[model samples]
Target: MRKLLVTLVLILTGTAAYLWFEPEDNPDALQTDQELLPDYVAENITRTLYNEEGYRADSVTAVRLEHFELLGFTQFEQPVYTLFNEAFQPSWKASSKYAIWFPQDKIILEQQVVIESLLQNELVERIETDTLEMLFPDNRLQNNQPVYIQGKGFYIEGIGLQADLTEKTLQLVQHQKTVYRNED
Candidate 1:
C-alpha cells in the first residue's frame, strides 16, 4: 500500500509538471493568424452608388455577396451591374457569373460577362466576353480575352477590347471577323 501511494504521488507530480510547462494554444492568436473572413454576407442584394453630384452612377445586384472590409474587396455570385449616364439614365448593363469589386472604383467580372447598351440607337448593342474589367470615373471597359460585339445590322469578333462608355468609343486590338446583314 505504501509503495502504491508513492508511485501515485510521483505520477501526479509528473503530470502537474508536464502540464505547467506545456505550451498553450491561444485561441485568439490562432484566429488572428488565420485567413481573413468576410465581414458581412448577404443574399439577393441590390446596392446603388451615387456620384459627387448626387446623381446615380451605378447599381449592382447579386444573388449572393460577401464583403471583406479588411481586404477592401467584395465578392459576388451572379452579379448584374448597371451604369447610369450623366442624366441619371441607365446606359450600360453588365452581368457575370462571378465578380470582385474593389474600393478603388474597379470591378472585375468573370465567367460569361455580357455588357449591353441600354441607350436607344447605339451602334453596339451588346458585348460578350469571358472576363471584363471596369474602371469607374471614366466608365471604361477593358479585357484581353476574346470579345464578341453585336450591333444593329452587324456583328464583330475580336481578341481584345477597349471601350469608353462615356465617349461611346470602342477599339478592338485584333479584329477576328465581322458579319453584316441587310435589314431589307
Candidate 2:
C-alpha cells in the first residue's frame, strides 16, 4: 500500500510539473497592432532607406528577419555596375566582376571589386581586394583591404584606402608598401 501511494504521488508531481513549465501559446496571436516591423521600414515608408542603380549580378542572395533587419548574403555579377545610396545618386561601374553587398554588419563589396567614377570631364579608377565597407553619412569609402587606384592625374597601389570623393583625396594606408606615379 505504501508503494502504491508513493507511485500515485510521483504521477501527480509529474503532471503538476508539466502543467507549470510547459510553454504557453499566445491567445491574442492574430492582433495586427502587435506585429513587429523593421527599423528601416518603421522609420519612414515614404523615405527610402537604400537605393541601387544599373545593378546586375550573376546570382543574388538576400536574407532578412521578420523584423526587416538585413542578416547575410553572397552574390556574383558579370559586367556589374551599380550606384548605392539613399537615392542612388552616385555611381560605380565596372566591365567585368563588380561589387558585393554584405548585409550582416555593413555593406561589403567582395571579389574582383572594381569601381569607376565619371564626373564631368574627369575619371577615377579603383581596383582592390574584394572587400569594401561603405560610409553612409559622408558617401565615402572605408576599406582596409589592399587597393590599386588610378585617377585623372596619378596612380596609387597600396594596402588600405579611405577615399573621400568630395575632398578629392584618397587616403592611402601607411606601413604597407605604397607606389604612386604621377602622370602629367
TM-score for each model:
0.82, 0.45
lDDT of 1 by residue, 11-117 (tens): 99999999999999998777765537888899999999888989899999999999887678999999999999988999999999999999988999999999999
Candidate 2 residues 1-184, lDDT tens each? Answer: 9999999999999999999999887656643334433334221111124424443211222232123333333333432434443333544443234333455433455667666764445456655556776554354677887777766566666788787654556677843543445333
Report how far residue 60 has shifted in candidate 2, in Å. 12
How far is each candidate from the true structure, as Cα RMSD in Å?
A: 3.3, 9.4
TM-score of 2: 0.45
Model 1 lDDT, residue 178, Cα = 92
Candidate 1 lDDT score at position 65: 99
Superposition error at 117 for model 1 (Å): 0.9
